[model samples]
Target chain A: MRWLRYLGYALGGILLAGCVAFLVAAWIYRDIPAGVLEAKYTTPASRFLNVDGVRIHYRDEGSGPPLVLIHANFASLLSWDDAVESLKNTHRVLRFDMTGHGLTGPDPSGDYSLERTVELTGRFVDALQLEHFSIGGTSLGGTVAMHYTATHPERVDRLILLSPGSLEGRSMQRAGRAVPKAADILKYIAPRALAEFMLTSRFGDPSRVTDKLIDQWYEMWMREGQRAAILARLRSYSSADIVKVTAAIRVPTLILWGEENPQAPVEQAAELRQMLGSAPGVTIITYPGVGHMAAEEAGPAIAKDIQTWLAAPTVRQKESVPP
Target chain B: MIAARPQLLSLLLLMAQAAAAQTQPAMDAKGWNLDTAPQSKTATPAEPPSTLNMRVYKDFDGRQQRIGDTSYAVDVSAVMTRCNDGSLIITALVIGGQLTPLDNHCPTTSK
Candidate 1:
């Protein structure tokens, strides 16, 4: 009889805890409607294009050679603000938030595969009537630009890869493996600290992760349907057969890496240079204290280097590539 | 016992964000705006509380919409960012009101 009483108490406690958790979440974490976030976070340079049914948020600045940049996973076009300012003065710099990220939110088609992202990129440039342009990306974006350049060699004049990711070894189901078992709970209860922690982890210098930056990131996460779209994208993540994909790139290539990049470390920079063997010319640069977000970490320096490389003739120009 | 950790963390984060949520960064800077764009092409731009470029789509989308018909589109938004003079310049960038062609989907609201 006493054991039965203990079981009843346990059940009651569990119910109470669940109720408290629910109430707490409800009070602090309501999804910020997309319209509200857009009005609050949209910058002076923001533009919206309804492409393939996805309202892609992007920026096109400067007025020379066109350069299209892609941001890293979980990040928006705002990540490249510093780099854009430096490059926009010379080349026509363009960058966009990937579907399911930033103001773009969820993709209406529900397709989050890498191939879809690449296709979206094609559609975007085609919409702009940009026949030819220099393509670049950071983190996940770097990987997409590489894939796009390989698939559409005619449209890409040069390729810039900054800490790109590859699913060469992750072709199988890798959902929620490194992720905590309680990952699903995250979709509903995203604490602001969690965002700060993630950004700080990615940054080489944690001190650089400012409160304002965290607010922007948190607000983006809070955007309506954004978190669900992000999780869906993660679950649907798969390789675009990136094995030996770099070898197919024949245009000039530039690879940038941060020495402290915990994810795609600087060591892989050498491997990337070797992989782009078919490229007419490859220049690889490594920043000492930079991390995965090199564009934001050392934007001006990267912009200066990119400007110089763009001006110089291609083909074995710099000895930066590892021999 | 372990379940309590996430709840505690959430409470702490809520407090932290509240403490950090001062509009000084927004007020000190220019403005913010995004898809608050008019659905009908012929609609007038809304007078926002703090949005900077809430005009005809003429920037990123390349003057896609003007005063009467088109506009622009860009993709960078930052709050509390100190400008060159370190002062926020929030104003409506109503370009030269250049008369651009209206999109087929966008009807002329000049009636």
Candidate 2:
């Protein structure tokens, strides 16, 4: 009887301890306030436009022909800050935080699918009343830009695909399977430490992962509705679906790649070129030692390339939609 | 009970490490070799002559047609800037040889 009583006491103690530990963890991993995040990330040029009930955060600067830039998944418009500064001198640049990212928060309808993103981008362009413009994006943003140009070729004067997403291929297929599972797990266990670690891993050089950058990324990830939105976007589409849509793009395309990109390997650049073989113009430039974050890593060089490409007599032509 | 407490503590530590590991890539080395390599540079074309003459023409059909010894096609309702080197930079719709900006009047709320 004494042994039985001791066993009961031990079990009760263990249960009480477990509850305390869980509560502590929850408190430690609590989301950062949106006000704090905005103070850190919102720049003087930061502006918001309501598209389909979603307020999009964007920056518009410079003068000359309009050039719209889209950021990668899990990133905001600020990711293109260096690139924007380099391009703004000679071009009218517009970069916006896509829905479910950065200051944009999340989609009101809880739909973060690529199709919905494409529709939102179309609406954004229409809202700006851009008769014709050049479009560019990095990673998932690259894929989004491709889809937008495919759907509205007459509106896109030129296209830039910077380390674009490729889910159909073998390397990306593996990433496609693993990323969603990780996001699913992360939705429930979103510790700031874990978020910071993930952001650091995206960079090829850990030294480039500054304390300020990590803090900004962690705060944005903890923003209201952002976690759920990111998870939904990860689970929304398949590699096969992306391949079907990408095969139809016919705009004059320039593909920039980081040779050492582990997430989206440099070999995928060749595949993208092949997929865009039918484009009126296809130019692929690979930075030898760079990695996944080329826009951030090699911003000035890329801006120069874009300016040169735009001025090239061979690439300059009136936009036309294919039959 | 004392033995179980140590075991439980170790288990919690292991779980935390595992969660941290999950956030990183599985590759052995995540760093890229950027220091040793020379940065890629884009070749810039020679600037056009500053004193070159400028001419413009009106294109009613929005086509790049040459007009009287000058290769200029002015799309109606478009803002066209003819460079000193005879290059054309268009910013808006060209309607009847006049530049018309797009009606982008969306309200912006500053953050």
Candidate 3:
């Protein structure tokens, strides 16, 4: 009977400790809704529109032909500010906070797969009455852009991939066996420091990762439902359809890389150009000391190149079945 | 105007294109017009047929091809140029091969 009482006491103590830890985490890592975030973060350029049941936050600027830019994972439309400032002078640059990131928050449909992203992008473009526009994106956005161009070759005039992830080697994109309920656990414990660490690690020049950049990233992460949505996106992500599509893209493709990109090495650019087998011709550009965030890190350079590419004739591309 | 210098330079280049000894293949335009041969799904065993990165000595008129000769221009090269403002412009009938720069014009301080 005494032994039984002792076991009961031990279990009670463990429960008490767990409850305390949960309370602390719940307080520190609580999600903040979009309304609160928008009040603090959005600028004069910010515009909101509902696309695929998500009230997407986007910005449209510049004046020439339409160019739609998608941001990286854990980043917002603001990520392309430097490039957009220069591009707007000659082009209509449109950037959106994707379904799970920035002020857009999460998709009500509860879907955050790359395919879901492509579908959302198409509907968004159609909603805006864009008959045809050039498309470009970085990292996760890069993957989505490539997926979109592959499937909707007719709709895209041009395609740009800035340090896109694992299109050639899907196995390497998310290596290691799945840890059960890991994403579930992550939903409850995101720290701003981790965001800072991740951003700095991806940057070719960490000195450029200012306090404002980290704050913007963390604020987006803290947006209500976003942390969970991001985790869901990573867990549900698939590059299974990429290889076939990469081979099917017939439009002129541009592959840009930062020589020091840690996330997707510069070598991957060569692999991607080879992957762009069907693309009539692929242009590869490497910024000597840039990194994964080339758009942010080397904005003017990319923008000028984009301007030149856009001015060129539309290279007729092959259509394919991919989504 | 995009920039006075670029605009002026573009006009000069246009003039140069008209006067150049070889007036680009009659079928061609401003940049090399990419051929209509579409790339197949299994582009692995055999490389797609296109002249990848043949440098254009001068920029011409794409519309000239559109209005006159063929469906689209065929001889295309992906061209990346560094502008005076330190910006870059990449031109193309771009498609295949490992994209190494056809020419790198790094600015030197001395004349």
Candidate 4:
């Protein structure tokens, strides 16, 4: 009887300890103040446009032919900071945070589907009165760009895809299936630490994962409703849906793939080439030792390739189309 | 034992309370808000691509049978050729019966 009482005490103590630990973790990892993130991330060039009840945060720089750039999942427009700098001199560069990302906050409709993103892109272009423009995207952004061009072929002149997501490959198919489940689990657990691990793992060279970069990403994730929005977006993604629309894109496309991309494997570039083979102009370039974040990993080389491709006769002719 | 039962019941109740508190939604934090800004009536663009471009591909059935004396195979569905200068060219099997020139090098032929 005494032993039973001791066992009861032991069980109660263990339960108490676990509850305290969980409470402490939840408090510590609660969303950081939005003001703190804005102070750290908002730049002088930062501007906002109201698009379909979503306040889009964007940056428009330089002067020339208009070029719209979109970032990958869990990344903001700042992902294209280097690429924008490299291209702004010769081309008008526009980069914006997609809905549910960066400071854009969550969509009221809670529709983070690729179709919603495509619609947002179109509205954004229309808002800017960009009749004919070139578009580039990385990762999920790449997938969005392909879908955008497929639907609005007349508006998009050239398409630049860097490590675009695909369902054709076994690895990416598995990733597509795994992401929503992972996001569901992550939304309820310790998100910041897991997100940091994920961000670091995506880089081929982990040394590139700087403290400042991690801090920015962590702060962005801490934005109110950002976590839920990310989960919603992840849940909405369908690689099979993307693979289908990508084939119909008629604009000139330049695919820059990292040789060792883990998330969207390098082999998908070949599959993309096959899908976009019917497009009038298709150029595929592979960087020998880069990873998924090609825009950040190989910015200079990518920028140079993009500049050359944009200036090429094929793209120039396409750019001349009337609004 | 009666006294111990009362103590045990209290401990169990406390444990249940702690578990409930811990499971509460994190969004209910005091300062958190949805941060809704002034709504804008920016004209929504025309509906974007809603349907998938489900183009069906003709399935080819065969094993690794060679296509004549050339380095191409019926099963492989790829052609390999060695140039006069020792360069090699390989063809890709395009779906939908379209064969585009794939500018990739063949490692086997190069060796």
Query: In lDDT terms, which candidate is top?
Result: 3
Compose the digit string of candidate 3's lDDT tens values, residues A1-323.
99999999999999999999988997888888778999997888788998768899998886888899999888988889888888888878889999889998889999987778889998888888888888999988888888888888998878888888755337555465453675576677788898889888888888878899898899889898888888888777776667687877877777777777877877667557656656765666566567788887778777766666666665443211111
Q: Is candidate 2 or candidate 4 better by lDDT?
A: 4
Q: Let me know the DockQ for model 3.
A: 0.06
DockQ of each: 0.01, 0.02, 0.06, 0.01
Per-residue lDDT, model 3, residue B21, is: 20
Model 2 ranges with Cα > 4 A deviation? A1-5, A168-185, A316-323, B1-111
Question: Per-model TM-score of chain A alone?
Answer: 0.91, 0.89, 0.90, 0.90
Tens-digit per-residue lDDT, A1-323, candidate 4: 99999999999999999989877776777766666667777888788899998899888898999999999888888788778888999999999999878888788889998889989989998999999999999988887888888888898988998887644333555644545465454443556666568767777676776776676677777787788899888767765565568768887777777665777766666566556634665555666556787777667767767886687666211111011
Candidate 2 C-alpha lDDT tens digits along B1-111: 011233322322332232222232121121211121112232124321111111223222334344332223211111222222323222222222222333321122200
**Candidate 1: tens digits of C-alpha lDDT, residues A245-294:** 87699898776666677877565654565456466655555555667777
In model 3, the Cα lDDT at residue A271 comes to 56
Q: Interface RMSD, all models, one decimal each?
A: 23.2, 21.2, 14.3, 21.1
What iRMS does model 4 reach?
21.1
Q: lDDT per prediction?
A: 0.64, 0.62, 0.67, 0.63
Model 4, CA-based lDDT: 0.63
Cα deviation at A247, candidate 1, in Å, is 1.5
lDDT of 4 at A116: 91
Mind giving the per-residue lDDT tens digits that candidate 3 earns over B29-79? 332322222321322212222213322212234334333221222222333
Q: Deviation in angstroms for B23 in model 4? A: 71
| Residue runs of model 3 more than 4 Å from their true location after superposition | A1-15, A166-169, A173-180, A313-323, B1-111
